[model samples]
Target: MKKFIPLSILLATLGATNAQADFQGTPTTNAPSWVTSWDVTVPCPVYVSENQADNIFFEGGFDYQDARKTVDGALGYRHLMSDNKVMLGANVLYSHEFPRNHQRISYGAEIRTSVFEINSNYYHRLTDWKLTGVDQNEEKARGGYDVELALAVPYVPSAHFRVKHFCWNGIASNIPTNPIDDLKGNTFSVSGSVYDGLSVEVGYIDYTSGNADYSKAGGERFLKVSYNFDIFGTHVNKATKPRFSNTPYEFERMDDRRFEKIRFEQKVISANKTDRDA
Candidate 1:
């Protein structure tokens, strides 16, 4: 009598090997350093005042490449205080890139309290940067902060997958509103378009106060356009077809008969060889 292997055992082994071949989707989060990004929006209860003015405003940026552009996606949560008149919120954003000779990941967090009843703009970018000069690579580590107030609605509301529109009209002033110097100004901006990951804004700004001076040469409006794709980053080629053709059902039966003949011949040959050696 001869021992035999179970079909279940063969299937279990094959399943383990196939599990390793599952595909993972490409990354679409990282972005270049020159890009300035923000996930800002105005929720309900405090509708934007600009919509009544018949003007629009917008600002946004995005870049994706075949794992080359990097990824900076975020998850944010907000809580309504005083029935949406006040909001206490926290946001987390991160970006990563794993490419040849360069592996970098950056993240940031923010906790803000705002009173929509009083137009306000409070945003800060917390990153330590090393600025390297041309002659000798220089790097400076520092964090930047921006806090301003507007006479109009402080939050602008817009959405993806919709016709983009945004506008902001407010008297903006720096941290210290007193003496107001060159730090105070009135700004009005308008923009409209769709979200293909690019945005532009144009506005008029004027400022005048004791120890303050600012000007926009006949309404400051500048054009900005940026696009990114992912070829420089990584090799992501894969084959979908199997390397060897599978045995047909009928051919499998033929294989079994052929295998039995080979087994008998091998046993006879082994016995002959043993006798000859003896």
Candidate 2:
């Protein structure tokens, strides 16, 4: 019988791997580098603010292809650094792939600043399957880690470029007789905001396996668009004045009138006291 490891133990082990490192934010929550072009890619969809405290966000998206389809969602939280220049946070993500019927769960931490972001994640396969010609069912417990970096363009406020490297060390459960036991890959991409809440991105990925006799290298590409906004109806006003309140001059006049009434009442009370004494 194949032994199964407890999920708690797995999580603990992953967490300890980077316990001593200083906190750094991820480009995006729980996203693998090969799958996204920017640190904050769309479709993986959670937004954490760098200036807001206790920010919580939820995002979901769908991706389609000729024979594969994917749907994913994320919930995340962020706390601003004391200086307001950095944000630290964590996220929990879930995704399901159709046709093949596989699912993934990821947990990770990230650090984000005005100029760049750093993110790390640990991914777990929740279900296991066997490919054709494989005699036995493969391991249900497989996962990996990825570290990503994103840099902002000095001239373009909305544009950011990113790179990532990752490693996966497990049996190849999805491909039959694939001589790969461990794989390492790198990804590169660029992303930019087109409008207030809309963004566009493009990325490329290449990877190689440890198998010396059958080493393989291939490239993957993607183009995507994503939008970010407050789900609770809290809209940010860009105007200098209050968008839904009275004008500043009107407010000042109201304050002045209240102060005048207070002064008149004080004078009347003082005259009454003096008359009683006399």
Candidate 3:
């Protein structure tokens, strides 16, 4: 459960960006030649404990984007607490954007309880790109950190209501100043289990960001639908097996067949001894 935060935050941010585009209105003349964007993600495995049992898990996934022709990957590990009420984990992510000829690397930690989760991560820019000007020699990269909080509530056996908040702060280098300022956003989502190892989700996002030049605020509406594959079956399979009683009477009842076999063997030995005596 803790390992899910990083991936969720990434997807939420991506969805928020799309929502912003819709709210800001489409550009008629300045629209890019390639306007539509699409993304696909695959989770190799998602191990969930059965019956709320305590356990550890590792998960990884790959992602592709059509707009930038970019590919990315993420990996994480999580450990459930002995009480089965909490979880802790960490994750690392990397992405390559071919259009901008740049890359991004990030890592973070997460903590989760029965109904809530908190995740914080730091991102590093690995490119020499100027945000303010086109001078290649004066280019400088930017980095930032983001924190996310998520909540879940069960509406039915297979349905849940989810909400999340995201906050981010950007830092700039000495040369080109950072165009983005502090950003804060919230998202509301509904998710439901479609099958044993599959589920579907839809969400909406709204946010405000402080800009360096204009110091303005804006909001966006976005939607996301996702399908999940679980290779290790479902949560029911991971439950702890029940333990049997060890009392003497119960043991005797359980071993009745063995006791009968022992008695028959003793009788056969006694009969053999009587024949020898005769």
Candidate 4:
């Protein structure tokens, strides 16, 4: 819209920088090519049967992420099992992370078969997670979880294969501070699909494990652009093919690993970069 206000003032005049430690981030909001980073899906309406699992649908997703200012909202439900190839899903999530503004709630589940897909997610951090901004809260435990495995090969359905595992500051509440849990992360990406909604991805995130510290190494490359929707016309994957957390590049790669726990829990790493890890 109006070229997103001069690319949001050139990404707020380039905020975080340190060349992004190799996890790839180099000022990008996709130019006058603005969509201002979005992820939206709406699919509600059902009734058409032959007992192919009755095929029900209900979807909703709202996300805004331009490198780090992430905002998310989602509500979902999908089903198509009855021996018709299987498909199941559930979602409920809310996120707000920006410059360490922390706020979170998450839950996800999935199951698919047509070419295999499995996803699981859990992130919790309702406040207090600042890294350079303050508030440690003992690394604010009790938040982090991810596991995804995807593949869609077999005549090139659109090309896909994803593998992900991440854990950032987990389990340990009731007030404490400083564990950071090494902020584990692992990623792999490959996606290509263009026609129905939109998708494009390229992945790599393993900045030498945990606390990303790479000056210019061999790891750190991630890029993605995703969009999803099916509002009033409702099609719902036509039967199956959108599980991995709303598949549109795996929901921005598991919502950008919850903003990489404030972008790699900084040790001096910041820059207007993008390749997918907020």
Which pairs of residues have clashing backbones in candidate 2?
A: 24-110, 24-111, 25-110, 25-111, 25-118, 26-110, 26-111, 26-119, 27-39
Over all chains combined, what TM-score does candidate 1 have? 0.27
lDDT score for candidate 1 against the true structure? 0.22
Which pairs in model 3 have colliding backbones? Answer: none
**Per-residue error (Å), model 4, residue 29:** 44
In candidate 1 the C-alpha lDDT for residue 34 amounts to 22
Per-residue lDDT of model 2, residues 1-278, tens digit only: 32434434533433332111000111223333233322222322234344345566654555544234666666766666545555676777776766555677777688765467687887776765523123432323236778888776554434567788876554532346542355566757676666655666565545554443223224445555555433433332111111222221111111101100000000000000111111
Number of clashes recorded per candidate: 21, 9, 0, 13
Q: Which ten residues in a row have the lowest lDDT in candidate 3?
A: 262-271
User: Candidate 3: global Cα-lDDT?
Assistant: 0.40
Per-candidate TM-score against the hidden true structure: 0.27, 0.57, 0.52, 0.26
lDDT of 1 at 119: 21
State the C-alpha lDDT per candidate: 0.22, 0.45, 0.40, 0.45
Candidate 1 Cα errors over 4 Å, as ranges: 1-71, 81-88, 95-133, 148-199, 203-278
**Tens digits of per-residue lDDT for model 4, 1-278:** 11112323433333222223322222233232221243444545444356434444434444444455555555555556544455566666666655555567777777765465777877766764345333322122236677878787444445566787765553332344422223456667666555455666555555434432322332344355555564465443332233333233321112111110110111112222111122
TM-score of 2: 0.57
Off by over 4 Å in 4: 1-76, 81-83, 93-104, 109-111, 120-122, 127-139, 142-147, 150-163, 167-182, 186-208, 211-278
Per-residue lDDT over 64-183 for candidate 1, one digit per residue giving the tens place of the 0 to 100 score: 332333334333333433333333333333333223112222222222221111122222222222222234332211112222222211122211111111111122233344221222
Residue 209 miss distance in model 3 (angstroms): 2.6
